[model samples]
Target: MQVLLDTLAPADAPRVADPRALTDEDLLALYAPPQQTWLRVNMVSTVDGSATGDSGLSGSINNPADGRVFATLRRLADVVVVGAGTAKAEGYSPTDTPIVLVSRKAQVPESLRGAPAGSVLMATCSLSDGIGEARELLGEEHVLTYGSHRVDLPALKAGLAERGWGHILCEGGPHLLRDLVFQGAADELTATTVPRLVAGSYPRITVGAPLDAHLTLRLLLEDEGTLLGRWFV
Candidate 1:
């Protein structure tokens, strides 16, 4: 991918990238969190703004370039926070990086459960009777509760940060992203616009309430008609 725009670069030196040589390490330099406790979201959408396809998974809209950035960001993140719905829809599971599954129902899919205690965490509330069962099925450290009525995103994030997981990478399923916005937890967003268009009932990349957020386009790159962009939110 080549750089099309880079507002994050110094004013004196305009940004430029050589598609022939650009690497994931280079992308990491441009996207690494600048602060200790930070949140960055990564997502891909179609030209028609559909965040997913009939299968309710964004993997169908992804490409090689997007895959590289996805892997790189996870490598740099202290923890990966994902909506439980997306985790189930996308067949998410534990990997080398730690993951915090956010859910109110305590309905963590079977796939994400039974992972190493050091690798997975489930954030839910007291109302969900499945919490104890999930903890037993997974592990004790695998569950955490925030609010009785709802998941307190700020407190959830703080608890993670206190555990030395400061740089947060949120892989949204829309509602979780919306919650992050409502709680003012997101700091950056990296989105990839796929070349294809799908005119379907699927919602746009963001389905949250209209709340004005001040953001600047920090970087933009493209390859094979796929637009990769980042913003400071």
Candidate 2:
């Protein structure tokens, strides 16, 4: 890891001489948000602005540096929020961390099935189908229903905050990221730009209606040809 630019660094020096020598704790500190209650998004993209590669998946476009940052962000977060589509596409499974699967539909992904009790949650709307099945699988307390038409992101955040999950990390599949930003719930974005070009019809990090959200870069790091940036929304 090469420290290109960091707003948190001293004015005399804008970059670290040997960021690669930093330990995991150092990395975690570098990416920590200023606020205790924060919504931080992590995403990977290509140089050509495509979010996916030939396989139409983010993993195909990610590198080891991005993976390190991803893991560190997860470690720093109190809860991990992800769209249902991305969870299935990325083959998400249970870990020590709790995961909240957000979906407009009530169907739970196959990979999340049989997960340990209280390890995973389903977040959907009251209008979704299969609500009974979702409640039965994840337990009634684990199934969070907010809006009648869609899962209200703001309400969901409040609910999670009420549960003491102040540090929120969203690993998106695009649509979810867009909604978070559009809803003004995103506090920061940590994006990694892989030094590769994959021109296709793939989506960007955020998809959906056009947004004019502004982001200010707070930290920038590079490893090999990859660029990892942290921006406040």
Q: Per-residue lDDT for 1-233 in model 1, tens only?
A: 77777777787764335534577777777676778999888989998899887777898778898998898889889999998888998899888889888888877787876676768788998787778876786677668899887788989989989999999999997888777877888888889998998787987767777767777887888888998888888
Please, what is the whole-model Cα lDDT of each candidate in the order they appear?
Answer: 0.83, 0.89
lDDT of 2 by residue, 1-233 (tens): 77777887678863334676656777887887787788888999999899998888898999999999999998899999999999999899998889999998877889998999999999999998878999988999999998999889988888888899999999997999899999888888899999998777888998898989999998988888999999999
Judging by TM-score against the true structure, name the best candidate. 2
Error of 2 at 105 (Å): 0.7
State how far residue 167 of model 1 sits from its true place (Å).
1.1
User: What TM-score does candidate 1 get on C-alpha atoms?
Assistant: 0.91
Best by lDDT: 2
